[model samples]
Target: MPLPYSEKVMEHFRQPRNVGRIEDADAKSIEGSPACGDMVAVYLKVDRESLRIDDIKFESYGCASNIATGSIITELAKGKTLEEAKHITWKQASEALGGLPPIKTHCSILAVDGLRAAIENYEERHGLIREHKPTTIEVIRKRLKRVMNPMVGLDLVRTKVVKDIEIADGVVRVAIDLPADHQFAANIREEISEKIQPLWDVQKIVVEFTE
Candidate 1:
């Protein structure tokens, strides 16, 4: 099938912007969608005084749409202030690509998320106020660990741990690794939500089953 991407998106995929690595990156983050088996790592150098992203690069492993998303996000973030970069939304990234298929929308969202995460890591290291919040997965993990019954045996019931967490637009997304045929998946999700309701405001929970 022909990809649902703009001419600009195809062009960027063919000739990606900022394709190489940054020699000295101020901030860097790696993200993967285990559900889709898409992984991307972004490296960035920001001008602290101006909060502007000076250089950006990416290494991606996924389909063409994933590549297009990373390329466009990097181009948009470079030379923009942290505040400005944070404002760059998935909608904008998708729009830049002409448009992505409904299912592929998450790929673009992941790119925007990866960029924001790198920036947040930069700010955290520099003692700047963090713009993103803790993801739902993080909260769930913490809660689970605290209340887990060691006597019940962690192995008896299928469990997924939070492998990666990101927050955007006041919503928390958690990447989890779980067994594909685990019969208790629904109950586990509910348990996680119930546990985290008091401590954090969770917007969404993304569960990724790894075979």
Candidate 2:
């Protein structure tokens, strides 16, 4: 039997870089979930004067690809200015590791998202963030695309699991096409909340199922 991963992927999995948390990290963000078995927490130490990522680290809870992606992204982001690091996409991270299986591509998404989220946190805390426009259904739907369905490893939007979306009075309501008792239902619901809860204009999130 042969491994599906590239040599670079295997190398990073065996010896992932920056594999721990920073005690006083300037900014940190956790993405994915335990239920999905693919969570990653990214920590960043930025040079405020230069707005550069002085150091970066990650802790991952997932498979080989997940660990490998996390390692590669941290390596790629280190020493880059936040503006530059924010341009580190999942595809770029995957290519850096030779490439990942299509099924495992979501791992790279999680890794890149974790890094970008940490950068966003740093910017928000340092008042470097831009003023967000009013949140709308399109904004909510776009964010939902990042919420992967654990069953297929694809986002809710792409999998067509998201049936509908609505917002009123600062509350966002999402209707997903899954049985309320489906095994992955809880995971999906939690993923949706994580993705939508960060909207500046969203005061609350409501996820409901529609079989």
Q: What's the lDDT for candidate 2?
A: 0.89
Q: Give stretches of model 2 more than 4 Å off.
A: none
Q: All candidates' TM-scores?
A: 0.63, 0.93
Candidate 1 regions off by >4 Å? 1-3, 33-35, 130-211
Candidate 1 backbone collisions, by pair: none
Residue range 93-211, candidate 2, lDDT tens digits: 99999989998878778888999989988987788857877888898888888788888777889999888898999999999999999998888888788777766788998899976
On residues 70-174, what C-alpha lDDT tens digit does candidate 1 reach at each position?
999998888999889988988888888888877675556656767877886787678786454554544445555422222232311234354555656555454
Model 1 poorest 10 in a row by lDDT: 147-156
Worst 10 residues of 2 by lDDT: 191-200
- Candidate 2 matches the true fold with a TM-score of 0.93
Q: Model 1: how far is 184 from its true place, Å?
A: 14
